[model samples]
Target: MTTYNPNQDAHYQILREMLIEARQARGMFQKDVAERIEKKQSHISKYEGGERKLDWIEVLQLIEIFELSEVDFLMEFQRRVFEFNESTQTKVLQNVAKNAAKKARVRAEIVRLMRENSLSFSDLAEPPIRTRRHKSNR
Candidate 1:
């Protein structure tokens, strides 16, 4: 069973509403979107109703169908979905910075290891080693 978080639920609801508004603004009916995505109208309805979750690929398809600019969509998402309080916003920014720093450290370590081993980028792409069987004396 999944525990419910009000904040997460609210975010999803906001996104659902935004998707519905975007569709309406484009003068698109649920049936039109359904045909474009090869889904039933009910599917689109469920998605817009927040009864179904939209995966990244589905979201991308919807973006294309709506002919929305990626930047506009992201700006709307930031404005609507991430309407956090001041303290929360600060915390989120801090976390993002911390994560980026950690990623940089990890990348530096990987580079150091590659240099020490004299390994090229293609060396990392090579296939895994296979074990050979040895004959045993009876």
Candidate 2:
């Protein structure tokens, strides 16, 4: 028996959605894509319905049939996989901006500390010195 994997299922679902969207966006029907890829309409339907997974070759074929460049197809796939609603996407962008600002502040602090301490690139290149120990007589 095969166990169900939610992650894998989600991945297939995203791919299926993107495939259907791309086909529709290009004003192509499933039948047309099926004919181009040498597959039956049912095969295209099954793939779009997430009942079947497309192998890499089939994906490449679909990309060609849809008249999409490989980069365009992959970019659409990525966009669908990480899609978010407008509000949520806005929040995420805001968080990213905040994080970037925080990083800039941290870098400024490091530069200030280095300057105040008179630190130089040569200091970083040199190795630490070890002290010698005297031998004791028994």
Off by over 4 Å in 1: 1-3, 84-138
- Model 2: lDDT of residue 3: 94
Residue 6 local lDDT, model 2: 58
lDDT of 2 by residue, 1-138 (tens): 999865567768877877788899999898988888788999999989877888998888887877879997788777765663444568879999999999999989877888999987687679989899999998
TM-score of 2: 0.54
In terms of lDDT, model 1 sits at 0.86
Off by over 4 Å in 2: 1-4, 83-138
Pairs clashing within candidate 2: none
Name the 10 consecutive residues with the lowest summed lDDT in model 2: 80-89
Candidate 2: C-alpha lDDT: 0.82
lDDT (0 to 1) per candidate = 0.86, 0.82
Q: Estimate each model's TM-score.
A: 0.57, 0.54
